[model samples]
Target chain A: MTSTLKTFMEEQLPIIESHMYEFVEDLTAPTSLKEAMLYSLKAGGKRVRPLFVIAVMEYLNNPTKAGYTVGAAVEMIHTYSLIHDDLPSMDNDDFRRGKPTNHKVFGEAAAILAGDALNTLPFGILARLEDVSAEQKVELIRLLSETAGAEGMVGGQVLDIEGEKRQLTLDELVRVHENKTGAILRFSIEAGAILAGATQEQRNLFVEYAYHIGLAFQIKDDILDIEGTTEELGKTAGKDVASEKSTYPALLTLDGAKEKLAEHATKAHACLEKIPSNSKYLADLTDYIINRNK
Target chain B: MTSTLKTFMEEQLPIIESHMYEFVEDLTAPTSLKEAMLYSLKAGGKRVRPLFVIAVMEYLNNPTKAGYTVGAAVEMIHTYSLIHDDLPSMDNDDFRRGKPTNHKVFGEAAAILAGDALNTLPFGILARLEDVSAEQKVELIRLLSETAGAEGMVGGQVLDIEGEKRQLTLDELVRVHENKTGAILRFSIEAGAILAGATQEQRNLFVEYAYHIGLAFQIKDDILDIEGTTEELGKTAGKDVASEKSTYPALLTLDGAKEKLAEHATKAHACLEKIPSNSKYLADLTDYIINRNK
Candidate 1:
């Protein structure tokens, strides 16, 4: 990782974690339900989504406490998706990030409720965001719902599941990745841009950067599934090929997948260049997405 | 049902159904996902939640098209909850309203996604409601996430599931119903009042009315589970008793439960009377809740 990106993560990771934990901790929910929700939230992931949100804010030099709150909201949504995606009926994974999945620890029923609770809680968090205009809150909620709802993440999930039963064309695979993984990643950057009050042109450029990195992020996952160890990835590796799930490497050869990743990385950096901001962290974060071990 | 409510339903039910169906139809999601979502929504239910929203608007004598939109939003949340509640890991019911449950029809993964999609789409619907101020939209979204989220329906669901393992005190039973069932019902009434520009005093009274009727709704449901045939109820009757679930009749006895239902009905009616408006439909709806066979 670049020193700039490393410094950013070192300074901001705890703030992100504490903000999320505090939000979940304050919910007047059942202790067990809260625990189930917290289990997945606390389960260590890269926090890449929140990093995108905050990085955009910092790049614009318009950082605010509300950025952290929005970051927490996006993280909760990301966490909830993981919990549900790990369900027995979905991916059926028992582990994530080297720990038992939410359903594994909380039982399926509580896990489902926990996912539901997490999904419902974020909008309330966004809606109640102080220091942001009501119009912005509405826009954020609207955008989040559009990107995260069936038309975006959930719809893409359905497409991905359906695609598993067939050999999808490259276009179909790109569509799935764009919706399933790309949508929320795009939301993270766009949310930061909205919160930072970026100009329309800057916001559009950030979205362009987000799109390339999103695909890069997923392609890296496919690559890591083959190359990275289970210990390093902190989850089961090589399961993708075993499941015969359509992945970038399954369609494109490994070298071709890596080439695609680098191509997107180059394009992402180019998009960042058009935006007039100190986006050194974002630039480094793009490299981090392409090269991350996990 | 009184002629007032009968007329209201005859006129408004189709409007509510079309509003909801159109919202789902307009979504740019996968066709199958949309079908899965539409299936449960089209499955026959009393539309009680939406009725509550519109009934409140009618009661205030300031109805608008936006009322139906908000009504659609609440109904979607209600529908999503029922879909998730009937999952195999949850209630494991094979049927609902005399038809196969969501998971049975769409597979568990799709059903879960459908429920998740439904859970999310409402806030966007509320956020984009025409004629509503941004502040009101934010308030609506905030209220919804609270009442329908961890602290309310989901938390109550956990309490209910835990209660099924053993007998619960009457207070615990009430708490379960208050959060599990009452919260969203309360949201319906409150949403209506908010949309209708009701005075705070009037809104508070409507909430009291909603609280009474909310419990009454559950008590009536519990009573129906015992007395109503599966043919009438369109679901597996007597399952609560078969599962040894804690319910109003189990705690209060059938006659005692009936008396309690009557007491709430009286209280609900009194609250309606306190609001100086044409609440004939609301009053009649309260009667319908207490007296309905299914």
Candidate 2:
């Protein structure tokens, strides 16, 4: 990671982690339910989504405490999706981030409720955000819902599941990734812009930047499933190919997938260039996305 | 049912149904996902929760189109909870409302996604509510996430699941029902009051009324499990007793449970009386909750 980006993560991640943990901890839920929700939140994953939110805010030099709250909310959403995706009925994974999946430890019922609770909590977090205006909260909630709901993450999941049963074309794969991963990435980036009060022009540019990075993020994931070790990736590796699930490498070949990733990386950089901010961290974060093994 | 409620249902039920169906239909989501969502939605419940929202508006004489939107949102939440509750790892029910459960029809993954989507769509609905102010939308979303999320329905669900392994004390059982079922019912009543511009005093009264009816609603459900036929209840009757689940009748005895239901009904009625509005429909709905066969 670039020193600039490393410094940013060093400063922000603890704050982000604490906000997420404290929020879940403070809920007046049953102890077991709270534990289940916390199990996955505490289960370490790269806080990439929240970082995107924070990075964008920092780039604009308009950081707010609400940004961290929003960051926490997005991370919660990501955590919930991971929990549900690992369910016996879904990916049926036994582990994630080097730890047993939520369902593995909490059992399927608790895991499902944990996922459900995590999903519901983010909007509440956004809704009760004190630093942002009511209108901004409304906008954030609306955007998050659109990107995360049926037409967004959930819908994309359905597509991905359906894709597993067939050989999807490149266009179809892109569509799947766009919704499954791109939607939330878009929210993370755009939300920062919204929270930072970015200009319409800057917001538009960030959306383009988000589009490229989202695909790059997923493409790197597919590439890592093949190229990285299970220990390094902190999860079962190469299971995508074992299951004959359609992935970038399956369709494009490894070299072609790398080329595609680089293509998006360049485009993402181009979008960032137009944003006219100290986007060094965001630019480095983009490099981090392409280079990261996990 | 009282003629007031009968007329109210006849007039408003169609509106509620259409609003919900159209909202899902118009979404730019996968067709199959939409179908899965709509299948359970169309499976037909009593529409009690949405009706509560609308009935509150009618009672306050400050009805708005947003009331129906909020009603539809609550119904979506109710529908989503039912879908998840009937999952294989959860209640494992084969049927609901005389039809196959969501997972039975759509497979486990799709049903889970459908429930997730439904859980998410409500906040978006409220966020984009045309007639309500941004502040109100924030309040509604905050209220929803609290009542329907970890500290509310999901927490209640965890308690209910744990309660299944052993007998729960009366207070524990009430806590279970309050979060699992009562939270959403509370949201329905309070959302209506918020949308109708009710005074704080009126809102407080509705909350108290919601509390009473919430317990009454669950108590009636337990009674129906014993007394109502599978055909009448549109689900497996007597399963609670069969599973030796700790329900009101299980702890309080059927007679004690009925008396408790009556007590809540009386309290609910008293709260409604304190609100100076045309509460005839609300009163009838309360009666319907206490005495309904399904």
Candidate 3:
């Protein structure tokens, strides 16, 4: 990535994090629940979701603080999903982002409630959005709920967990990844399109880009599990193999998985080419996704 | 309580249950998640919350099917709270409504996800309400989320869990109950008022009515835990006492708790009297709150 790209990320990342912190620092919650909500939220993240909201709004020439609201809400949902997924009964992961999981630090009950609180806060935040029309806010909420609910993230998590017991074919694996991980990521990408009132043609192109990147993101994570380290990945490496969960590298050779990643990246770029916006920045974000060590 | 009141509950309860079942029977959710959600939802609730929505809307002369939307949303929150609360990590209860808890039937991870799904369903449901304006819908969502989320039900659960090891004073216990139990009940009542665009004067009166009945409801629950049987209650009897959780009967004697229930029930009726709508039926419902054996 260019120095300009890095600078853009450096500038935007903290704004996303600052908005997240302000959102979490509420008075209604007990200190513990608030602490639990803020703990993982403030923990380092790529700020990819929030950035998508902002970038999409910017691309449409309607950059507004509403993007920040939508961005913070999505981030809260993403962080909550992670907290619940790491519970002892679920992934049993002791660490995430090189720090103890929410359940590890807070007790299981508090962790669960923290996840619950974070999940519910989004609706309240979206409902209270002053910048958006009520219709738009409701639409945003519908998109978000559909992405996060039973048929989306939770359903995908179920498939992923059940897949641990046996080898899943590429199709089954795709379904799991799409729901478990892809759904939210796609929402993150296309949410900007939805918020910015992109034309159907533009929205379709963004979705096309989102789909390729979503698959590429998961394939890269599977590759990273094999090739990356605990220090670099910020979590235990080789967990897929240890858990016997199916992965791109497990089904396809490491070379083949890397080839698939490259294919998706190329395809994602092709979609970006068709868009009218100065998607040069989006292309840079995609490159960052591709080149990130973590 | 009049036979007419029994007739009212009998007729309305099934409608509420049927609506709840229809809401849960979505085509999008995975079968297991849907089953887990439906399992608790169909476990034969008394439909108190839905009835509140319906009745309050009727009292405001704006009765509509949207009350079912609000009712279903709040019940989903209530049921989700129960699912999470009954987890082995939290209350560790084995049964609810005389059946195995969600975790026991669907496994802990599914239970957690099921709870999460149910929690998210409310927003989509409320956001889709056809009868209410977008502004009213947002207001309804805000009220429901506040009551169901951290400041309301989840916060109360945290307080209740924290108070498990210590004997709480009456004030602390009431605060816990008011949040944990009373908040949602209040929402159930005022959600209709908000939906119907109640004047501030009427809203305050409804709040007064809801507050008294909310306390009465909790005090009666404490009394039931002591006086009712496992079969009668459809839940393990004396759970609060066994867990050393404070209760009205524990702090106030059984007689004292009964007196308190009567006091709140009477106060609730007085508030109902000032309201214009033939709230005589609502008054009857308060009497039932005092007289209910289970």
Candidate 4:
């Protein structure tokens, strides 16, 4: 299971993205709607969430079709969130991943429908999966829906919208990030654990691992907003500052934010050390999150 | 089973509303987000979809928690669709059911998120149900998502938006309404059938019944748009004509439109007659759909 992380990702990313494209393609759909969905999904994403599922399965020396299906499903949810977040009513961003946003290309109504479709396709995919036990599938679906639903990502979105209007305290910021970013990342890792048949103890470690990386991931994003260039970041740089929105770097200085990022990355790596699996890929991914220019 | 329909509705409507309100209430969260969600769900209206589930369950004499849960879940999806459909990017309606739309009350961003949450919360509710087998739950969820997802309600919505811009052929209009309105109503009746363990044959009849009634329902809506005043309709009247949107009465003469409505209602009744369940309520409900002023 311990292999060159780059080689492993090289082998996995294509399959993951292909699976994603396959799930969304329909025989007689409006061409624009399907195209809008595929454009955002295929925009050269890192495929971190799906890969987390795959890597976790690889780490445990247990793999199943459930891994790929759930992997693609989580990635769909993530992509849909991005699509919606970029709407005129929300962040009003013109670009994502260095390309025009979905609305910019598809028009606002189609973009909204595309986001709705992507957000919705995952559960249907999970429910249609028959290779797994009904109980297991339900467990995975329950966890996914709850984590991605109102009290989680959507709730965090509400808080984020509010935060754009006013400065949030540190505690409020933490709560927001944990719900928005942490919830889905947590679902990504936990879904893999469930499919891998991990014991509660191992699952807890994965939870701890995802928790640290989730925060680290956001903190790095905030840092990148300050330090990274537009080309490097793909999206516009200094967007948080331009919008007058708070970020880790906004509240703490840049150096303080970098330190915060390191602390969480270290904690995440330490948690991975406790798990009895070849989790080095996850370890490498955590580092990659902090070091990524975009 | 054949009690006065109004008497039965009076008894059932409050409980259904309560179930809805209960699913969305979350402590330790932003009061405004929750408030926005509740405001739409609590808006006075005929809880027709949820009531369909309850009535179907009663007709089959197969009452279970799944009925209430699925009823609430579908209603949530219905409400969420209404919210998103009213957004500035979509229909841009100022009022619905005689009150300001969710975006008018909650701001555009919150309204969008509120719709997202409601659309999402249903699958979680289905997944978390313990009374039914996981297989059953999965079936329910798969059906719900598929009917409500891209190829179904959302797909229909894309066509509806397109229809507003140009005239649609009668067949195209039928496709749009079936997808947008027919699918959810189909899911409602079919869900109760699944819960009651109806044979595939009965489910097919329910499908036909839903199809006929769904078209009838839309034709009646078009008729109301032409004949009803703004006060009776609760939203703007003559909207289809104002927008140059095609309708049954537009494609056919007004008398012809009435004949078409009657034709579908007759077909719906014939299908209902074949089902063995105590379906008087469904029959009465179909009559209500075509005759209601609003």
lDDT of 1 by residue, A64-159 (tens): 999899999998888889999999999999989989898889899999999999999999999989999999999999999999998899999999
**Model 3, span A27-121: residue lDDT tens:** 47677778888898987777788887777777677777778888888998999999999999998888889898988898899999999988888
Per-residue lDDT, model 3, residue A149, is 91
Using all chains and alpha carbons, the TM-scores for the candidates as numbered come to 0.99, 0.99, 0.97, 0.97
Which candidate number has the best DockQ? 2
Minimal lDDT window, size 10, model 3 chain B:
B278-287
Candidate 1's chain A scores what TM-score? Answer: 0.98
| Model 1 chain B: worst 10 consecutive residues (lDDT sum) | B275-284
Q: Write the per-residue lDDT of candidate 1 for residues B188-229, one digit (tens) a residue.
A: 999999999989999899889989999999999999999999
Q: Across residues B217-241, which tens digit of lDDT does each residue of candidate 2 receive? A: 9999999999999888888899999
Candidates 1 and 3: which is better by DockQ? 1
The lDDT-based order of candidates, best leading, equals 2, 1, 4, 3
For each candidate, give the TM-score of chain B: 0.98, 0.98, 0.96, 0.96
**Tens-digit lDDT track of model 2 for A5-45:** 89989998999999999999998989998898888888877
lDDT of 4 at A221: 87
Two-way lDDT contest, 1 vs 4, winner = 1
How many pairs collide in each candidate, listed in order? 0, 0, 0, 0
Fnat per candidate, as a fraction, reads 0.93, 0.93, 0.69, 0.69
What lDDT score is found at residue B270 in candidate 4?
Answer: 94
lDDT of 3 at B221: 88
